[model samples]
Target chain A: MDIIAQLFAGLSLGSVLLLAALGLSLTFGQMGVINMAHGEFMMAGAYTAFVVQGVVGDAGVSLLLALPLGFVVGGLLGLLLEATLIHRMYRRPLDTLLVTWGVALVLQQVARDVFGAPNVDVRAPAWLSGAVEIGGLALPRTRLFILALAAVCVVALALALRATPLGRRIRAVVQNRDLAEASGISSRATDRVTFFIGSGLAGIAGVALTLLGSIGPTLGTNYIVDAFLVVVAGGIGQIKGTVIAATALGLMQAFLEYSTTASVAKVLVFVAIVAFLQLRPQGLVSVRTRSLA
Target chain B: MRPRSTSRHGVTRLATASLAALGVVALSACGARVDSGSAAPTTAESCVDTSGDTVKIGFLNSLSGTMAISEQTVHDSLQLAAEEINADGGVLGKQLDVVSEDGQSEPTVFAEKAGKLITSDCVAAVFGGWTSASRKAMLPVFESQDSLLFYPVQYEGLESSPNIFYTGATTNQQIVPALDYLAEQGVTSLFLVGSDYVFPRTANKIINAYAQAHGIEIVGEEYAPLGHTDFSTIVNKVRSADADAVFNTLNGDSNVAFFKEYNNAGLSADEMPVVSVSIAEEEVGGIGVKNIEGQLTAWNYYQTVDSPENDAFVEAFKAAYGQDRPTSDPMEAAYTSLHLWAAMVEKAGSFAVDDVVAAADGVTYDAPEGHVVVNGENHHIAKTSLVGEIGADGLIHTVWSSEQPIEPDPYLEGYDWAEGLS
Candidate 1:
C-alpha cells in the first residue's frame, strides 16, 4: 500500500519536475546561455494567478484566467529580457549568466518592495481543493489535476514541435542558425519565439506551483535547482528526455522519502542526478540540431 | 545529540562580511583602546569601545539562495528594531550603526558573517539567524569571538551556547507543552512527521524519548525534503497507521500540501488531531483554515495570546509593518530579542560583550508574549507554552496553556530516559 502510494506521489512530483525543467532545458541546453532568472519568471506567473484570484474570489475562474495570463506575461517578459540583456551577450555565455543573475536580483528586490518579503496565499480553487478517495487512499484532486495537466502539456508541445511551421523554424534554428538563415528562416525571430514559448511554459509551471502551495518571491528559487537537475540528467533540450528523466528522478525521490529521512533522500536524489550526469553529459538525448549550434 | 561544528571558511567570511558591514565606523571602533576594569565598562576598558560615538551592530541573513525567504524576515525585523532604537536616541548615549551582511542561506556563510560581525564591525552584539543549521554554524564563531548573538526562533533544544541569547522558545516550553495537552485530551497514539533537517530530526528524537517515558505509543514516523510537496503517500500511511494524533514539524509550503492531503484523507482534528509546531498563524492562512481549523498548534506567541503586552506588541507590529501584515512566532521572538538585548545592555551599563553577557545571568524583560527572564547559564529564555486551536479568522486561539512560564531547559535535564542525549 505504501509503495503504491509512493508511486502516486512520485508521479505527482515528477509531473512538476517535468514542467519546471522543460523550459529550462530549452533556454539553457540549446542556447548554452543559462537563465538564472528562470525561477523568477515562474514566480511572476504564480503571483499573477494570486492577483487574479484576489479579484475573482473564485478558484476555477481565477486559475483559468491565470493559466493564459501567466503564459502571456511569461512570454512578454522573455522577449523583453532577450532583447535587452541576453541578446547582447551571445558570445559570452558566462557573462549572460552574471547578467541574468543581476536580473534575478532586481526581480527579487522588486518583489520584496511590492510584496514586502512575505509569503502570499495562493488558494486552490474550491472545485479542485478537495480530495478523491482511490480505494481508501486519499489523493488530492489538485495533484491529480496537475498530473493530467502535465500530460496534456507534453502532448501539445510534442505536436507543436512535429506539426507546426514555427516548430520547424525553431528546430531549424536549434540545429543550425546559419543554415536556417540561408534557408530564409530569421534566426533572430526564431530565438525570440523560442524564448517566448520557453518563458510561457515556465509561467504555466508557476501557476501549477501555486496550486501546490504559497506563492512568494523565493518560490521559484526553491525548485529551480531541482528543475535544472532534471533538465541536465534527462537530456538537455529534449522534452521527451525531460519527461523520462523527471519520472525517474521523481520515483527515486519518492521511494527514498518513503524509506529514509526526507533530507537524506533529497541529498541522495541530488547525488544520483550528479552521478547520472557524469555518465551521460549530453543527457539521454544528444544535441543534433545544426541551427541550435 | 549532534555536535554541529562551524566551518573554518564560514567563520573567516563572516568576519570579513561583518567588517564590511561596519564600514568606516567599525574600522575606527576596532582601533579603540580602552581599559576600564569597571563592572559594566560603559566606555573604558571594554574589549570594543562605543563611547566615542556610534555603535556598530550587524544583521546577518541569507539575502540570496533557498533560505532567503525565511531568513529575510528576521533580517528585516532586526533592521526595524535598529531603526526604532535609533529613533529613540540610540543606546546608552551612542547611536547605532548597523552593517548588513548576507549569509546566503548557507551555514558556511553564516559562520563568515558572524566573524565579520565580530572582527570587522566589532559590533557590540549581532542579531539574526533562523535555521538550526545556521545557528549551529555560527555558535562557535560567537563563542570564539567572545561576542553576543540574539537568536530569534524556537528550535529543538538539547543545545545551548554561552555567547548566544536564544529569544525563541525551547522545546520544553513549546513542543512538550503541546504533548502534555494532547495527553490530557487522552491522545494515546501519535504519528511523527517533519522536514528532514537538524531541528526536526532532534525534535523527533526528543518526542520518541518523551513518548517512551510517558507510555505513549509511537505509531509511525515520516519525513520529507525541505521543499517537498506531494503528500499522498504519507497521508495514506497516517490514515492506515491509525494514530490518534499527528505531530507535524514540516517547514515551508510543504504544509499546504500536507494539510490539504490530510484533509483529503478525511483526517480532521476531530478524528485524528494534528498538533503542529511549524505551521503558525502566517502559515495557517496559506494552508487554508478550512482544511486545518480546530487543529492544535503549539507555540509561545499567538496574536491571541491574551495580555496588555501582547496587545501592544500586536498593535506596534501592525503600526510598524502595516495594519494587514500579521505577526507570527518568529517575528515576535525577533522583536523580543532586541528589547531583551537592550535590557541586558541597560543592566550592564556598557556595550562590552563580556559585561553584557556576564550581566545576562538573571536579566528579565516584559516581553509582548509575557515576562521572560534570561538564564545566564544557558542563554535561553524562560517562556510560557500555549497549544491553540486554529480559528476561522485564520488566527489561533489558546485552548490550553502551561499556566506559567517554563524555565529554560534546552538539554532536557529533567528527563531520565533521555540520559546523555544532550
Candidate 2:
C-alpha cells in the first residue's frame, strides 16, 4: 500500500516537473536561447492569479480566468524581451545568459516593489481542497488536478506543434534558418511567435503552481534550476525526452527521499545526473541533422 | 628579442620577491595576538561616541533576499521601538541616532555588516537577526569588539555569549513547554518534520532525548531542505506512521507548503495535530487560514494575547505601520529588547559596555509578552511560553499557557536527560 502511494506521489511530482520544464524546453532547447528570466515570467503568472482572485473574489472563477490571462501576460513579456534584448544577442549565447540573468534580478526587484517581499496566499477552490481516499491511499485533489493539467497541456502542445501551420514554420526556422528564410517563412516572425507560446506555457505552469507552493517573487528561483535540469537531461528540443526524464527523476527522488532524506535525495539525484551527462553528453535524445554550423 | 625577454623575467622575479617579503611581514604582524580564552581575538578599544546629544545604534537585518519578508518585520518593529524611546525622552537623556544596514540574507554579509556597525559606525549596540546562522556569524564580531547585540528570535538552546542579549525564548521557554503540552494531552506517539538547518537539527535532537525520557515513541523523522516546497513523500510517511501528533520545526515559506500538503493528505488538527515552533501570527496569513485554521503554534506571544500593554503595543504598531499589519512574537520581542536596553543603561547611569553589563542583571520590563526579567549570567530573558491555535480570522489565540514566566536555560542544565548533549 505504501509503495502504491509512493508511486502516485512520484507521478504527481513528475507532472509538476514536466509542467515547469515544458516552456524551458521550447525556449532553451528548441530556440537555443538561454533565458535566465524565464522563472520571473512564472512569478508574473502567479502574481496575475493573485490579482485576479483579488478582483474576482472567487477562487474557482478567478483560476479559470487567470489561465488565459496568465498566458497573455507571460507571452507579452516574452515578446518584449525577445524584441528588445534577445534579438540582438542571438549569436552570443554567453552574453544572452548574462543579460537575461540581470533581467531576472531586475524583474525580481520590480515584483518586490509592486507586491512586497512577503509570500501572498492564494486560496484554493473549495472543490479542490479535499482528498480522494481509496481504501488506504489518500490522493489530494490538488495534486490530481495538477497531473491532469500537465497531461492536457502536453497533448495540446504536441498536437499544436505537429498539426498547425505555425508549428511547421517554427520547425522550419529551428531546422535551417537560412533555408526557411529563402523559402519565405519569415524566420524572425516565427521566432517571436515561438517565444510567445513557450513563455505563455510557463505562465500557465505558474498559475497551476499556486495550488501547491508559496507564491512570492523568489518562488521561481526554487524551481528554475530543476526545470533547466529536466530540459538539459532530457535532450534539447525533444518533448518526449523531457517527459521521460522528468518522470524518471521524480520517481528517483521519491524513493531516495523515502530511504534516506530530502537533502540527501537531492544530492544523489544531482550526482546521478552529473554521472549520466558524463557518459552521454548529447543527452537522451540527439537531433539527427546533416547541416554543419 | 632574447635580451628583452630576459629583462621581463628579471622584473617579474623582482616583483614576486617583494610580494613574498610583504606576505611574511603581514603574517608576523597577525601572529602577535593574545589568547583571551574565547573565540574572539584581542579586542579593539571602544570607539562609541556618547558625549554628544545623540547616541548611535545599528539595526542589522536582511532587507532583501529570501529572508527579507520576515526580517523586514523585525526591522519595522525595531524602528518603532526607537521612535517610542525617543518620544519618551530618549535613552539616558540623549536621542538615538539609528544606523541601518542590510544583511542580504547571507551569513558572511551579517558578519561583515556587524564589523562595520561596530568599527566604523561605532554604534553602542546593534539589534536584529532572525536566523540562527546570522546570529552565529555575528557572535565572534560582537565579542571581539566588546559591543552589545540584542537578538530577537526564538532559537535552539545550548549557547550563550556575554556580549549578546537574547530577548527571545530559548528551549526551556518555548520548545520544552510545547513538548510538555503535547505529552499532557496524551500524545504518546510522534513524527518529526523540520527544515534541514542548525535549529531544527538541534531542536530535534533535544526532542529525541525528551521523548525517550517520557516514554513517547518517535515513529518517524524527516527533514526537508530550507525553502523546499514539496512535501508529498514526507506527508505520506507521516500518514503511514500513524503518529498521534507531529512536531514541526519548519521555518519560512516551507511551512506554507507543508501545511497545505498535510491538509491535502487528509490530516487534521483533531486527529494528528502538527505543533510548529516557527509559525507566528504574521505567518498564519501567508499560509492561508483555510489550510491551517486549527493548527498549533508555539511562541512566547501572539497578537491575540489580551493585556493592556499588548493592546497599547498593537494599537501603536498598527498606527505606525498599517492597520492590516500584524504584530508577532519576534516583533514584540524586538520592541521589548530596546526597552530593556534603555532600562539597563538607565540603571547603570552610563552607556559604557561594562557599566551596562554590571547593571543588566535582574532588570525587568513590562513588555507585551508580560513582565520579563533579564538573566544577566546567560544573557537571555525570562519569557512565558504560550501554545496557540490558529483561528479562522487569521490570528493565533492562546489555547495553553505555562501559567508563569519560565527562566531561560540555554544549556538545559536542569535536565538530567540532557546531560553531555551539548
Candidate 3:
C-alpha cells in the first residue's frame, strides 16, 4: 500500500516537472535559445494570478480568469524579450544565456520593488483544499488538479504543433530556416510566436505552482534548475521524451527520498543524471535534421 | 548538407559545456565554507566619535534576497527602537546617528558588512542577523575588531559569544519549554522536520536526547534543504509514521509550502498538530490562516501577548509602519535589543566596547515580551517562552507560557542529558 502511495506521489511530482519543463522544451530545445529568464516569465504568471485574485476576490473565479490573463502576460513578456534582445543574439547561445540571466535578476528585483519582498498568499479554492481517498491512501486534490492540468497542456500543445499552421511554420523554420525564408515563411515571426507559446506555458505553470509552493520574487530560481534538468535529460525538442524523462526522474526521486533524506536524494539524482548523460550525450531522444547549421 | 561534421562538433561542444558547468559547481561548493580558524583579536582602537552630540550605530539586515521578508521586519523595528531611544533623551545624552547596511541574505556579505560597519563606519554598536549562518559569519568580525554586536533572533543554543549580545531565546528558553509543553500535553511520540542547517541540525540533536531521557518514542526524523518547496514525500512519511506530534524547525518561505501540503494531505491541527518554532505572526498571513489555523507555535513573544509594553510596542510599530504590519518575535527582540543596549551604555557611562560589555550583566528592560535581563557572563537574555496557536485573525494567541523568564542556558549546562551537547 505504501509503495502504491509513493507511486502516486511520483506521478504527481512528474506532472509538476512536466508542466515546468514543457515551455523550456519549446524555447530552449526546439529554438536552441538558452532563455535563462524563462523562469521569470513563470514568475510573471504567478503574480498575474495574485493580481487577478485581488481584483476578482473569489478564488475560483479569479483562477479561471487568471489562466488566460497569465498566458497573455507571459506571452507578451516573451515576445518583448525576443524582439528586443534574443532576436539579435540568435546564433550566440552563450551571449543569450548571460543576457537572459541578467534579465532574470532584473525581473526578480523588479518584482521585489513592486510586490514587496515577501511570499504572498494565493488561497486554493475550497474544493481543492482536501484529498480524495483511494484504498485508504489519501491523494491530495491539488496534486490531482496539477496532474490534470499538465495532461491538458501537453495534449493542447501536441495538437497545436501537429495540426496548426503556426506550428507548421515553426517546424519548417527549425528544420531549414534559409529554405523556409526563401519559401516566404517569416522565420522571425515564427520565432516570436514559438517563444510566446513557450513562455506562456511557463506562466500557466507558475499559476499552478502557487497551490503547492511559495509565491515570492525568487520563486522562479527554485524550479528553474529542475525544469532545465527535465528538458535536458528528456532530450531537447522532444515532448514525448520530456514526458518520459520527467516521470522516470520523479519516480527515482520519490523512492530515493523515501529511503534516504531529501538532500541526499537530490544529490543522488543529480549524479544519476550526469551518469545517464555520459552514456547518452544527446539525451533520451534527439531530432534528426539534414540541415547543417 | 555538412551534417556528419556538424554533429561531431555539437557532441564535443556539449561535452565541454557539461565539464565547464561541473567546474563552476565545484568552485561554488568550495566557496561555501568560511575560514573559521582561530586568529588573535585585533586590538583596533575605537573610532566612534563620541565627543560629538551624536553617536553612530549600525543596523545590518538583509534588505534583499530570500531572508529579506523576515529581516525587513527586524530592520523596521530596529529603526523604531533607535527613534524611540533618540526621543527619550538619547543614549548617554547623545542622539543616535544610524548607519544601515544590507546583508543581501548571504553570510559572506554579513561578514563583509560587519567589518565595514566596525572599521569603516566606526559605529559604536551594530544590531541585526536573522539566520545562524549570518550570526556565525559576523562573529569573528566582531571579536577581531573588538566591537559590540546585538543579534536579535531565537536560535539553536550551545553557542555564547562575549562580543555579541543575544537578546532572543536560547534553547532552554524557547525549544526546551516547547518540548516541555508537548510532553505535558501527553504527546509521547514526535517526528522531527527541519531545514538542513546549523540551527535545525543542532536543535534536533537536543530534542533527540531529551526525547530519549523522557521515554518518548523517536518515530522519525527528516530534513529538507532551505527554500525547498516540495513536501509531498515528507508529508507522506509523516502520515505513515503517525507520530503524536510534529516538531517543525523549517524557516522562511518553506513553512508556507509545508503547511499547505500538510492540510492538503487530510491532516489537521486536531489530528496531528505541528509545533513550529519559526512561524510567527508575520508568517501567518503568508501561510494562509485557513491552512495553519489552530496550529501551535513556540516563540518568546507574539502580537497577542497582553502587556502594556507589548501594547505600546505593537501600536507604535503599526503606527510607524502601517496598521496592517504585524509585529513578530524577532522584531520585538530587535526592538528590545536596542533598548537593552541603551540601558547598558547608561550604566557603564561610556560608549566604549569594554565598558558596555562590563555593564551589560544584569541589565533589565521592560521589553515587549516581558522584563528581560541580560546574563552578563553568557550575553544572552533571560526571557519567558510562550507557546501560541494561530488564530483566525492571522495572529498568534498564547496557549501556554513559562511562569517566569527562563535563564539563558546556551550550553545546556543544567541538563544532565545535554552534558556532551556543547
True contacts kept of each: 0.34, 0.49, 0.53
Q: DockQ score of candidate 2?
A: 0.26
Ranking by DockQ: 3, 1, 2
Instruction: State residue B57's C-alpha deviation in candidate 3, in Å.
Output: 1.2
Candidate 1, CAPRI quality class derived from DockQ: acceptable
Docking class of 2: acceptable
For model 2, the superposed segments whose C-alpha errors exceed 4 Å read B1-41
Highest DockQ: which candidate? Answer: 3
- Model 3 quality (TM-score): 0.96
lDDT, residue B215, model 3: 88
lDDT value for model 3: 0.88
DockQ of every candidate structure:
0.32, 0.26, 0.51
Tens digit of lDDT per residue, candidate 3, span A198-230? 999999998998899888888888888888888
- Tens digit of lDDT per residue, candidate 1, span A1-293? 66787888889889988888777766765555468788899999988898899999988889999998998988788889999988887665557667887898788888778975656777777778667877866677888888987898788888887899988887776666677788998888878888888888889999988877657787777777777777766666578788998899888988887777566777798677657756765677665642212
The regions of model 1 sitting more than 4 angstroms off are A28-33, A90-92, A267-281, A285-293, B1-45, B48-127, B264-266, B288-291, B341-363
Model 1 lDDT, residue A140, Cα:
75
- Which candidate comes out best when scored by TM-score? 3
Q: In model 3 chain A, which range of ten residues has the least summed lDDT? A: A89-98
- Over B1-422, each residue of candidate 3 has an lDDT whose tens digit, in order, gives 21122342263344347435844864463245455324324677778899999999999999986688889999999999999999998998999999999998888788888888988899999999988888888888898888999999998877888899999889999899999999999999999999987889999999999999988897999999877788899999999999999999998778988999999999999989999998888888878889899999999999888999999999999999999999999999999999999999999999999999999999999998999999999999999999999999999999999969999999999999887888
**Model 2 chain A lDDT-worst window of ten:** A284-293
Error of 2 at B1 (Å): 44
lDDT of 2 by residue, A1-293 (tens): 98888899889889999988898888877777778788888889999999999999999999999988988898889999999999888776657777987998999999899997778999899889979999979999999999999999899988888899998887777666677788998888888998998899889888998999988888787778788778777877778878988999899898888889999998899889878876776567756544443
